[model samples]
Every structure is written in structure tokens, then in C-alpha cells.
Target: MAKDNRIQMLPAEWRASTTLSGVYALRMLGMFLVLPVLALYAAGLPGAADNKALVGLAMGMYGLTQALMQLPLGMASDRFGRKKVIYFGLIVFAAGSFMAAAADTLEMLVAARAVQGAGAVSAAVTALLADLTRDGVRTRAMSMVGLSIGLTFSVSLVLAPILTELVGVPGLFALTGVLTVISIGVVAWATPNPQISKLHEDAEAQPARMGEVLRDSRLLGYDFGIFALHASQMALFTALPFALVDLGWDKVQHWKVYLPATVIGLIAMVPLVIVGETRNKLKQVFLLGIACVAAAQIVLFAGLGSLWSIGLCLAVYFIGFNVLEASLPSMVSKTAPSDLKGTAMGVYNTMQSVGLFSGGAVGGLLFQHYGFSGVFGFCTALLLLWLLVAACAPAPQPVKNLGFAVPPAWQGRQEPLRQRLSAVAGIEAVRFSSDGQTVYIKALQEGFDQTAAEQIISGAN
Candidate 1:
């Protein structure tokens, strides 16, 4: 295909990707809206007096529960159907939201948040995305979902202080519950169900592929990169709001700092990632990002006394954060066997949750005992370690996506067609479902020719 021809419009499945992602945004808004404001409000509650540690515990406990349940829920969706599992998860999330909304003390909030986290549905949502779209468009669709989450995080950060002042944490929880209910209706009524199949029986037959994924030196490096990235993120937030307070910025004006910085960070992140993936300099880009992260932590530690410094640190932090987030997923996709992509993502997400819980809990303790300097020190160390690990990871294979139209004869020759394609050189894997009328192939570089493959189909007919 010519360069111009290679660029395609966003496929139709993007609509469902956007809608499902909106549901995630709604859920996250409830969770993140309180992050900046929670510690301040907890001080006023009856049992929250001087126990900032407890506040930290409450903030991060949800992650622990979320981590534990992600994969199991996803596997369950395979058995019960995606929509059914999604609805069940949403109800669980709504119940947790209500519990948190009703809580009068810090301890109650902690328990309630755990319940909310327990409704882990990321895997289910992912499976739903896969079920609703063709494989060719699925990556782009997932990108939309990712974009939604990032945008939601930005919106929540800007809105959190203002919303917190007006309705408080409890009110935010109620709003989340209402949005979740709406999400249920959307899932049931609006989304179209795409056909599903076991496309990679060969990969499944070799159960050791999973062990390979787990033990793969390169993926492990990226896995550690994710854990460190999130851990630092959790630790930093433990003190960021208070640090800004000391610098004379009020809660409501937090958006003033966050909004422009987020824009700047996003602007810087996109180009670097494009270069990294297109040029095959993934490890280099990932390491550079970690270096920037460490620098941000250092800046945070050195300059807690001024608002300008805080803003600069935040700008640096977000730039690094956004780049790593985008690059990591692409790396995983490029490196993972197309067959076990879901399972690899499942494990990656679980690590992220583990980081979240650990970050909050460890950050709290560090702050309570060692103060702000300690939090920065902890986070800085994490970034440094991540940088080292990322530097050592093997480079990912260059990706070139191929799309093919099904031949008219494919109607009756599904198995034969697949068998013929499987024997072709350079083709790594093929998925052909007669009912779905689609074929997905992952190929080796410079081996398979699309025109030649097309001719074979024509001759077979």
C-alpha cells in the first residue's frame, strides 16, 4: 500500500470504544475526583484527627481490591458473556459508591472504597471492546478508550477542587453511581455485539507461552517500568496538594496549574512516542521518560517553597507520565504474541493495580514518618530503578499491520483457506471465522506479500 493509502479513517467500532470508555471516565471521575481533596476533608471527620496515615490507607486500599479481581472477572466474562459481566461489575461499583457516599468516618470510607475497587471490570471492558470490533480496527478502538481515560483524568483534576467545595466527596460518589447506572443502560441498549471466537488454538495448546510471557526478560522489564511508574505516582500525590498549599495556592485554583501543564505535557508526549514506535527506539524513549520522571521528583523535593517550582515539577512529571503510558501499551502490543495479547494485558493491568495500592500505602507511611522529603526520595528512587530496567529491555519488533478482504469462495472454504494461509511463508498466525467473515494475520517482516496472497485466493477460487 502507498503511504497515503496506509492512513485510514477511524473505523466504526470506535463509536463503541468511545462509549465504553466514557463509562470508564465516569467511574474514574468518582475515584480520582477525591484524590486531591480527600486528605483535607478527612481531617474534619470524627476519627480522622491527626491520622494522615489512615487517610492514605483509605485512598489506596481500593487499588488492592481492584488488582485482585481484574483477571478473574475477565475470565468470567468469557463464560457468562461480556455484557452480563459488565452489568454485574457496574452494579458492584454502584453499590460501593453508595457505601462510600454514606460513610461518616475515615474507616468507613476506606472499607467503602475497597468495595468500589472490588468491582474490577477493566478486563471485561477490554473483552467487550474486542467483541465489538474487527481485529484490524481493535487497536485504534482501544486507543480511543485510552485517550478517554487520560482526558477524564485531566477533567477530574481540574474539576475536583471546585466540585469538592460544592458537593464534597459523598456527593461525588453519588454522581458516580448515577453515571454508572446510565452506563448499564448504554451497554444493554446502544452497543452492537461483534462475533467472538478462539482464534489462536495453537497458542492455547502451548500453555508454556504464558510462562514465556511471564519469564520473558523484555516484558518483565516493561512490567517493572509500569510498577515503578505507578508507585511513584501514588507516592507523589501523597504530598503534592499539601506542598502546593504551603506555596500559597488554594484548592480551587489547582486547575490553573494542572490545566496548562497537562496540555504542555500531552503536546510533548505525542511526537516522542510517534518517533519511538515508528523508528523502533522504544527502549531509548522509555528510558528518557524515566529520566524526566526522576528529574521531576528531584525538582519537587528541592522546591516545595514556591508555587512556580511546583508548577514546573508538575509540567515535567506529566510529560514523562503521558509518554510512558502511551509507549508502554504499544510496546506490549508489538512484543506480545497476538494470540496471548489479552492475557499479557491482564497481567500488566494487575501490576498497575498493585502499584496503586502499594504507592498509596507506602507513600502514607513515608510521609507520616519522614515527611515530604521522604516521599520525594522514595519516588525518585523508583524512577531511577525503572530507568535502569527499561534501558536493559530488548527492542520490540517493528509492526506493519496488514488488512485483507475475504474471498467470495471463503464462504465454504474456511478451514481450507486457513490451512493454505498457515502454510504460506512469513505468516505467523491466522484467524478465520466463517460466521464472522474476517481474517487476522500477524506476519514476519518482509516475508508475506499482500498482492501475492490475493492472487493465491483468486487461483484457489
Candidate 2:
């Protein structure tokens, strides 16, 4: 293949990836829009005033349900269909959002959040993306989904305070319900249903390979790190709003702090990501990110009473978060054997979702008794654990995930084809489906002989 022979999405793939990303973003928007303002609003609600712990549980409930359902929903997609699962999940999510909008009590809100989290379709969406796109363009398509979530978070931070001022928190939840309902229509009308769906090794998890990926020491390190990352995230927000209010910032003015911190954090994140990928310093970058997160917590602990200090701490946290979020998945792919990639990701995603719930639950309980400093102390401990584990983990070699077309005649010849590709010096791992129409590979990017691999595969046919 020529260096300039760029991989491109077909019109259908382009629409599908974009629309699915939008759908995912809608769901995330509902979740994120609540984060910045909910702590403030919940404090005024029933049960929340007497016991702030109720506020934490309400805040984190979605994550608990999301974690519990992610894998099962993904598996369900295989049995029923991707679109069917997605439509059902979206409906459930919308219903939950509306229920939340209607809730007058913290208990009611918590229940609604649980229902919202139950609509976990993340794995299903990834599987559908794999079904829709060829290997050459799949990563880009997936990145679009990830990027959508990050963008959604930023937009929600800005929009939430404005929305809350206009419609109130319940109104914001109602808007989430409405947007999600619209997104369901988008999923139906815009996303092309996959003709055939299977356990996509590159895109979705396989239960059979769980043991291998889970037992690996390095992958476990990343999993623990992600868990800590999200846990700290949920805990921080559980207390941040109150801390800001105490610092004399009004609820509506909260966006002023969040807007700049998020924008600049994302800006600072870009360069760190580049250095990690281009400079082959991923482990060092990962450690540095962990250190920043710890530093952010310490800053929060020390400066909760100061507006500028809180702003700076939030900015640092987001910068670290963006880098780790991008780096961890790539490292997981690089570390796992090709066939078990999805399984590894399945566990990783589970850890992330569960961390949200844990953070909310634990952060709330800690804050209720020990106050803001206690919450920060706990999060600081998590960051410390992540730092220790990440330090011992090996630096990842520079590897990239690549997809190739396999002809129908080669369907039964995976062993020979694997041997042929493995002989290519840069290829690290090769995996083909039972049907053998698509091949996924991890290879050293520096000297990968794409031309030779293409010719040999074409010659096979």
C-alpha cells in the first residue's frame, strides 16, 4: 500500500459511526450534565440535607447499574441483535431520566439513576461499529465515539449551569430524557443495522478468554488504575460543588470556573498524548499523569477555600484524565494477545463503570462523616495505589492495531495465514475469525511492511 493510500469510511460507515457517536453522546450528556450541578441541588432536597450521603448515592447510582449491565447487554446483543439491544437500552435510559426528573426525594432520584445506568449499551455499540466498518477504518470510527463523549462532557459542563438556571435540575433531567428519546430515533434511522453480528474480537468481549486477559499482571495494573481514576472523579464531583459554594461562587457562576478549566485541560492534554504516542514514552507519560492527578487531589485538599486554587486543581485533574483515558486503552491493546483484546477491554470497562458507583457511595459516606478533606484523603490514597502499580508495569512497545481483508477461499486456512503474517518481522500478533473474512493484527509501527503483507495475503487467494 502506498503511504498516501489513506483508509476512508464508506458513506454508510461514516453516517453510522457519527450517528452512533451522537447517540452515545446523548446518553453521556444526561449523565455528565448532572455531575456539576447535582451536588448543589441535592443538598436542598429531602434526605440530602439531613444526610449528604444520600446525595452521593444519587449521584453515583447510574454507574452501579451501568457496570452491572454492560457485559450482559453486550452478550444480549449477540443473541438478539445490536439494534434491538440499542433501542431497548435507549428506551430504558430515557425512562430512567424522566423518572429522575420527576423525583422529589433523594431515594426516588437514586432509583431513577439505577434505572438509567441499566441502559448500558456501550459494548453493543462497539460491536456494531466493528460490524459496520472494515479493520482499516475501525479505530478511527471508535475514536469518534470516544471523542464524542469527551466533547459531551465539556459541553455539559458549560450548558448545565445555564440550563439549571433556566429550567432547574429536574428540568435538566427532563431535557436529558427528551434528548435521549430523540437519540433513539437517530439510532434507528441513521445507523444501518448489521447484516450479521458475532463476537468481534477487535470490538467486543468474549467470555471464554476472560481468564487469560484478567490474569496478566500488566493489564491488571491498567485496570486498577482506571478504577482509581474514575473513582476519584466521582468522589471529587460529589464534594466540589459545595466546596465552590463555600468559596463564594454562585451556582450559576460555577460554569465560569468549569469552562476554562475544561477547555485548557483538554488543550494541555493534546501535547501529552502526542508525546506518549510519537515519542514512545507512554509509561513515563502514564506515571506523570498519575502524579498530576495526585497533585490535583492534594491541591484540592489544601485549597478548598480558595477559588483560584480550586480552578487550578480542576484543570490539572482534567489534563491528567484525558491523557490516561487515551493511553490506557491503547496500552491494553498493545499488552493483550490479539484474540483476547475484547475480553481485556470488557474487564477494563467494567472496572471503570464500577468505579463510578464505588466513588459515589464511598465518597458520600466519607464526606457525610469526615467532610471534604476526608474525601480527598481517600481519593489521594487511590491515586497513590495507581501510581505504585503503574510504576512496576512494563513500558509498552510501540505497536498499532491493523485490519486486513481475508478472501473467502482462505476461510479455513487461518493457521497457514497466521504463520505467513507472523513471518513478517514487525507483526506482533494475528487473529482471524472463524469465518476468516477479516484479520486483526498488532504490529510494531516503525517498520511494518504493509506492502509485503498485502501481497502475500492477496497471493494466498
Candidate 3:
């Protein structure tokens, strides 16, 4: 095939990916909008006085429920329908947001947050996306989803402080509810319906593969890394707002610190990621990111009293945070068995939610007992342990997923097709759909003989 003849997304595929990305981003924006202001706002609620633990619970409660509901809701999408489950999840999320808006106490807020989290729709949305797009274009579609989440986080960091100042926490929660409701309409009208929705091993978790994914030590390491990353994030935010306030920055002005730190950190991350990918020094780059995060914690622990010093620390933290956040998933994909990728991601996402809850609960408890020292000390220690785990783990080789259209004659001849593809140089693993219409290959990033594979796929060999 000529270079320009490569498969590209059709108009329908483009519409599906973009609209679904929008739907996913809207839901995530609702969740992220509260991260910066939740702790400080919750502190003023009834039953929260001097009870930072309760405040933390209020802040992190959504993660616990989200973790518990993700798999079940995903499976429910299989049994029911994709759009139906998504609509249901959105309604539940909206209800919780409204409930949270009316909460008068920390306890009420925690319960409301849990309700908010029960609407886990990520897996279903992903599965639907896979259903709508051909395998060759799926990765591009998925990247859009990831990009939306990153953009949402950046927007939330800048907008949260200003929004909080204008309407207060209760009003923010109400606004989230409204946005979620609007997302339901997007799902109904804007999002395209899939012709067929079935279990897609590349996109949805499989029950039989659970043990295989869980037993992989390398995959487990990536899972732990994600857990640590998000836990540290939640813990840091649990105390950061108050720290800024004490440093003489008003709640509304906190964006000044976050906006610059996030922008600069993102700018700094580009070159490191480029070098890591282009030079094959991913492990080195990954470790450096870990060190940056740990160093930021140490800076905070040493008590940076000035706003500028704290801002610098935040910039350092975001640099590490963004790098790890971006690379960890890539590493997981490289490490996981091609067929079990979805299962591995399911487990990875679950651990992330668990980490969020743990960080908030523990950070609050630690801060209440030992002040900022305890919070930053815990974050520093966690990242150091993660760095050690990452250092000792096997380095990941660069690889990419390649999908081929299996000829109709190849149906019921899995063994032959598998053998032929497996014999191709640099093709590490081969998996086929149950119907045998598609073949997924894991191949080395370099030395993949695409022409040879294509010839075999086209029956011209």
C-alpha cells in the first residue's frame, strides 16, 4: 500500500469520535471542577469544624463509589445497550450533583459525592467508540478521549478558583448538575448509534482474562504507579488550598499559581516525552519524572512560605505529574498481552480510583494530626517507593498495535492465520476476533515488515 493510501477515519467515524470525546469531556469536566476548591469549601460546612478527616472524606468519597461501580456498569452496558447505560449513568450523576448542591454538612456532602461517583460510564463509552470505528482508526479515536481528559483538567485548574469565587461551592455543584444534564442530551442527539455493540476484547474488560491480567507482575507495577500518582494528587490538593490561603493568596487568586504552574509544566513535559520516545530512553525519562514529583513534595515539606516559592514547587510537581500520567498508560499498553489490554486497563483505572479515596482519607487524617509535615511526608515517601518499584521492574520495549482485515476465507482457520502472522519478523503476538474478520498484531516499534504482513493479509503471498 502507498503511504497516502493508509486508512483514514471516514466522516461518520470522525463525527462519532468527536461527539463521544465531547460527551466524555463534559462528564469529566463535572468531576474535575471541584478538585481545586472542594477541600476549602467543605471545611466551612456544618460538622466539618476542626475535622479535616471528614472534609477529606467529602472530597474523596466520589472515587470510592466510582471504583466500585466501574466494572459492573461496564458489564451492564453489554447486557443492556451502550447509550442506554450511558444515559442512566448520566442521570444518576446529575442527581448526585444536585444532591451535593443542597448538602448542609460534611456527612451529607460525602454521601452526595458517593452518589455522584456511582455513575461510572467510562468503559461503556470506550466500548461504544470501539464499536463505531474500524480497528485501524481506533487508536486515534481513543487518543482523542485521552486528550479531552487532559484538556479538561487544565481548564478546571484555571477555572475552578474563579468559579468558586463567583458562586461558592454549592453553586458549583448545581452547575455541575446542569452540565451533566446537558451531556445527556449530547448523548441522545449528537452521539452516533453503533450498528452493533458486542464485547470487544481490545476495549472492554473480559471476565476470563481477569486472572491473566492480574497475575502479570509488570502490569501490576504500572497499576501501583497509577494508584500512587492519583493518591498523591488527592492528598496534595486536600491541603494545598489552605496552604495558599495561609501564604496570603485569596481563594480566587489561587488560579494565578495553578494557571502558570500548569502551563509551564505542560510546556516542559513536551521535550522530555519527545526525547523518551525518539531516543528509546523511556525508562530514564520516566524515573526523572518520579524524582521531580518527589522533589516537589520535599520542597513543600521544607515549608516554602512565599507564594513564588510555592508556585515553583507546584510547577515542578505538575511537570512530574503530567509526565507520569501520560507515560504510565503507554507503558501499560506496551507491557500487557495484546489480547488482555482492555482487562489490564480496567484494573488500572480501578486502582486509580481507590488511590484517590485513600489519598483524601489518609491525607486528611495525617494533616489533622501532624499538620502539613505529615501530608507532604506521606506523598514524598509514596513516590520514593514508586520510584524504587519502577527502577527494579523490567524495562518496556517499544511496540505498537497493528490491525489487519482478515479475509472472509480465513474464517474458521484461526490456527493457520495465527501461525502465518506469528512467523512474520517482529510480530510479537497475534489475536483474532471470534468471527475471524479482524486480526490484531503486536509488533515491534522498529523492524515491523508491514509490506510482508499486508501481502499475507491480502492472500498475495
Candidate 4:
């Protein structure tokens, strides 16, 4: 049979990817909806009126629990099955949301947020996505998930304040619980179960390889990058709403600023990302993003007393935030060893969760003592540090993963096949599954010679 080289996803693949992306997006939406208004809402609660630290903890408690449970829940999926784990996680998340909605005190809200984070089903969702898609199209499937997250975040920023005005923070939590329950239904009925659920190293983390992924200096740099990026984001939010209020904008009207800022930032992000990926100038683009974020913080620290000035500063910040958010995982994929990509992502995500926790906790403390200047100043310093770390790290090679089935005859001839494929132009590194069923290649993204590689695979050379 001739190979089907078309890049379009099969109908089933589309269904799987779309539904899974929806499930992931819903879960993320639940978290994001609170971010824009959580600090302000928490401030009004008992035991929080005088304690910005407690409010910050309420904002960040989710991250702390999420960081702790993310890997364990993912590993649980391996043992108990993906759907089972995902269902369990969604239920726990919904329970937490309800708990948060009913809470009357900041302390109770903090515990509820911790419960919310305990769901930690991101890895399982990704693993299930990997299970449902073919190797050739897995990257596209993954991109859908990433796109959903970005869109969810943007929508949340615009909607959170408006929603808070209508139903208040408790209503938001209750709504999240309702949406999460709906997501559970989507998982059971909409998402197709995979016929086989074995591990895919390119998509699922492996415990045995954790040390190797951790020790790589390049991966560590990207890890720190994600950490700083999210930390800065959480830290910024801890004080931004209050700042807007002080500047004479009602909390609900703040969306006017966010709407335009987010739109412009997204528009600006497109050209930079395209140039970076296609032109092989990713490092330069990345550093520029960090600089933009740092500059925004510096502006805030220098004092933006008017809504217009604050809005302009946010536009710059979002440009950097969106670019870094989109590019960091791609950089991680390029930097990690071909087979250890999953493990590297696992560690990278853990660091992100930790950053979220730290930022909220620390930002709140700083804001309580030193006000807006302290919060922005701390964020600026962190980003500058990350920029330096990223600068010293080696530039990432522009490569993408390609997987092909191992022919029966080639199963026992791993070394020879590796050498043959590695000799092919554009193919940089080759790795085989332990059972020799699949061969994964790290090939140049721009001009991978798929036909040549396929011909070699079929013994037609």
C-alpha cells in the first residue's frame, strides 16, 4: 500500500483532539476565571481584610496543591486508566469549586483553592490525547490543546470582571463547578477511548528518565523560564486590580483596558512568533519578549497613575507574556533529548506550578508591606534574572519529532536502521522504542525529507 502523506487529521483524530481540547480548556477556564478578580474578592472576606498575605494565599493555593498532585495523578492514570483518573480529578475539582463558593472566610477559601488544585489532571489529559492521535499528527493535536488554553485565558481576562459584577466571586466558583461537571460528561460521552493505552515517551513522562531530564542544563533553563513567566503573571495580578481601582476605574470597567490590551498584544505576538520559528531567530525573539515584560514592570514601578498608562503597560506585558507562553514548550521540545521530551515537560510543568504558588504567596506579602511598587519591582527583578539565564543557555536547534512504524524485518536491525536514517539529510537524531515497534526521528522543521525517510523505511533504497 502506498503511504498516505496528507497532513490532514482523520475524522476520528479530529473528534478526539477537539473534544479533549474542550475538556482541557474547560478545566483551565475554571482556574483562569478567578485570576482577574480573586485577590479583590478575597480581600473582602473575614480574616483577609487586614491580611493581604491571606488573600494572596487564596489566589495561589491552587498552584501549591496542583504542583504536588500533578505528577501523582498522571502516574495514577498509568495504573488505573486515563478516563478513570480524569473523572476522579474533575470530580475533585468540582468539589473544590463548591467548597470555595460556600466559604465565608479567607482561610476556608484558601483550603478550597488547594482542593481545586488537587485535581491536577493536565498530564492525564495530554496522555489521553497522545493515545488517541497518530504519531504523524500528534503535534497538531497538541497544538490544539495549547490554542485552547490561550483562548481560554484571553476570554477569562475579558469576562472575569463582568461576571464578578453579575454573580460575585461565589457565583464564579459555583459556575466553575457546574462547568466542571459538564466537562466530566464530555469526557465520558464525547471523548473516544483509545484501543491501546501503552506509554508514548514523546507524550507521557517516565519516572526512570526523570534524573536525565532534570540534569540537563538546557532543559533547566527553560524550566526556570516557565517558572519566572508564571510567577510574574501571578504576582502581577495580586496587585493589578487594586491598582486599577485606585486609579478610579471600577473593577468591572477594567475589562475595557484588558480587552484592547489583550487584542493588541495577541496581534503583536503573531509576527514575532512567525519570525522566530521560520527565520530561526527564536532566541532573539524570546529575549525580546522577556525584555518587554521587564519593561512593563519597570513602567508600573515608575508609577502609572492613570488608566491609560496602566493599559499601555499591560499591552506590552501581554505581548511578552503571550510570546513566552507560546514559545517555552516549543523550546523545551527542541532542547530535550528526543525520547525524553515527556519527562522534560513533566518537570517543566511542576516548576510552573511552583512558580504560581510562590508568586501569589510572595506578591501578596510584598504588596501588604510595600504596595504596588514592591510587587512590580519583584517581578522585574525575576524576569531580568530569567533573561540572563536564557541568554547564557545555548540556542535551540529548530527540529520537530517524526515517528514511523518499524517494519518487521527492521525490528531486529535497530543499529543499522538508525545509521541509515541518521544519514538522511534533515534527520538529526533517531530513537527506537524498547520493543522496537516505532522509530522516532528529530528532523529539521523547515525541510524534513519525509519521502526519503519513508523510502528508506520500506527498504526501497
Top lDDT model: 4
Candidate 2: TM-score? 0.97
Query: Which 10-residue span in candidate 4 carries the lowest summed lDDT?
Result: 1-10
Question: What is each predicted model's overall lDDT from 0 to 1?
Answer: 0.75, 0.87, 0.88, 0.91
lDDT of 1 by residue, 126-237 (tens): 7787666654566666778888888777677778888877887789888888888898898887776657633321111122455867976777777777888888887777
Model 2: per-residue lDDT, tens digit, 1-461?
22224866789899889999999899999999989999788878886775778888988889989999999999999998998899899999999999999998888989999999999989888888888887678778888998999889888988999889999999999999999999988988888877777767877888877888878998888889889999999999999988888878889889999998889878988899899898899888889889989999987776576788888898888888878888898899888876677889999999999899999999999999999989999999999888988888789889987777786656778888889989887888888864577787778979888777877777742
Candidate 1 wrongly placed segments (more than 4 Å) = 1-14, 194-209, 400-440, 443-448, 453-461
Order the candidate numbers by lDDT, best to worst.
4, 3, 2, 1
How far out, in Å, is residue 181 in model 1?
1.3
Model 4: number of backbone collisions: 0
TM-score of 1: 0.87
Q: What's the number of clashes in each of the models?
A: 0, 0, 0, 0
Clash pairs, model 1 backbone: none
Q: 165, model 2: CA deviation in Å?
A: 0.5
Following a full C-alpha superposition, what root-mean-square deviation does model 4 have from the true structure? 1.5
Angstrom error of the Cα, residue 327, model 4: value is: 0.8
lDDT of 4 by residue, 162-189 (tens): 9999999899999999999999999899
Off by over 4 Å in 2: 1-5
